[model samples]
Target: MSERLNGIEAFVAAVEAGNFALAAQRLGLTRSAVGKSVARLEARLGTRLFHRTTRSQSLTEDGQAYYERCRRALAELDAADAALEAGRLTPSGRLRITMPEVLGRVLVAPLLLELGAQYPELSFDAAFNDRRVDLVEEGLDLAIRSGPLDDSTALAARPMGHQWMGMFASPAYLAARGRPASLEALLAQASAHRFVGYVRDSGRPPWQFRDAKGQAVAFTPSSQFDFGCNSLEIAAMAAMQGAGIARLPVWLVREALDQGRLVRVFEEPQAFGYAVHAVWPHARAMPLKTRVLIDLLVERLVPALAVR
Candidate 1:
């Protein structure tokens, strides 16, 4: 029974870590030991688990089926462990999470650090990225996403807060170019003004706004002076430097607005914005650590983002 358990642990670790060496590192076991344990398990099961190459290992069909069952079984065991830990009221274990780079660095990281200081037993492995990731495939424990989430039974989501899109410019730029009184006026003189556009996989995105009737609209400005940036921080910086007007989330530029570095181009509030969510894989029992973090995020982040 002990040997069987060891083999199962090795196999699961290898899959999650993406290689034997890394799995060994994670498990604090020698690489050769991990490989041998998996080999023994395969020999007993009478089927090949991995299609191995010198550089990489991919799961075989049978391996994929086995892994799914094993993962669920392990989750059940983890739930049992978490239940016991809940009584102690202390969360221990590493949480693997992901979030957008700027949001993670500016907001989430500080919150997590505070949590860590409060709970000495807790640890974290975080990935700050902009691209969407599959939580299960990536073995992530949680994700903080901004914008709409696709419907999925495999995961659960909680709304953290929302961010409003606002058009902003530096005082110098606004003084020189003059502010457009309305969205229509801005569109009419789109060529006369420059824009700092946000770029993604689909290229630069159009600035989002809402019509008087509360209908969504997009404005794609055209100007040789306009430039594209992949980072929101950079776009905000460019706007501060008087390069061009930028469409940015209100929370991101709140400090600049307060410091008189950036001014709102339009006084009317725009209804166009996106909801933020705290997402995690669905489980029979939620880990105490995950629950604690989620609660903290709601307590701290919601209020911060809620303020206009």
Candidate 2:
């Protein structure tokens, strides 16, 4: 109905502006008119779209889901309008993307900013977090993720490149305890030293690694310190302060190594690596803007961040 469309528009505007009054102003309607429209929408849908208080207006869980879908719909409408207005216009739409925090910030964010500059009509919604998200359920257009993706009938993944892991420690720590030349020496010396490690899902430390030759090798951490955490940045910082040795991505510690703040422990047959991929839903045909965004990421981010 006309009322429903009006409500959807008002609700979507409210989410984007973060307030009902702003949405009303944007729509050229009284604040009460916008509020009533949204209320009628909630009544028709049998779910609340936002939590309104004197100080703030925030989306509820159902509201967030509805907002995502509505936003996408509005974006598609805008894209269609622009295409009609400007013949042969490059892809122009809102792209909803997700990625891990570190990679998102250091790698993808810049590429998106550049893409926005190139495509004047394009906009984006990007979420950065380490936790895995259900892209289809959450209405995300794309996700950049590292490591093996679980098989999903509804999702598709495109492999981008490999990420190499390395062990690093600060110079102060090395001077005090001395660096080991080989895996055996490293293991022998590690038993007396503190180590920062990954936290497993079961609330235990991640499994240590070893080479094929089983030389008590470079992958295994010493039994001396058992401190564990889920964040690689945290582990790296701990190592920088001589808290312990840390296994982390080369991209993450490159600056530290260059500045002589951290030293690579093992060089050959680099241990603990994972493949990075761009994942999206298989059910939906990727919009032109989303496809262009993915291509831009592949062209710009892969070479910049991939391990040499």
* Pairs in clash, predicted candidate 2: none
Instruction: Provide TM-scores for the models.
Output: 0.72, 0.64
The C-alpha RMSD in Å for every predicted model, in order, reads 11.7, 14.9
Pick out the ten consecutive residues of candidate 1 with the lowest summed lDDT.
148-157
lDDT for each residue of candidate 2 in 227-299, tens digit (9 for 90 to 100): 5777777888889888777777788888989999999866644355667988886522446787788788778
The list of candidate 2 runs beyond 4 A from truth reads 1-88, 200-228, 283-285
Instruction: Give the per-residue lDDT of model 1 (tens digit) for 1-308.
Output: 65676788789989999999998666645687779889999999999999999989999999999999999888888778777776876888999999999888898999999999999999999999888899988889999999877644356678888877788999999899989877888888887788886788667666778887888888878733276778899999999999998888888999999999999898544567788989897554678889899999999988878755
lDDT of model 2 at position 178: 79
Candidate 1: C-alpha RMSD after superposition: 11.7
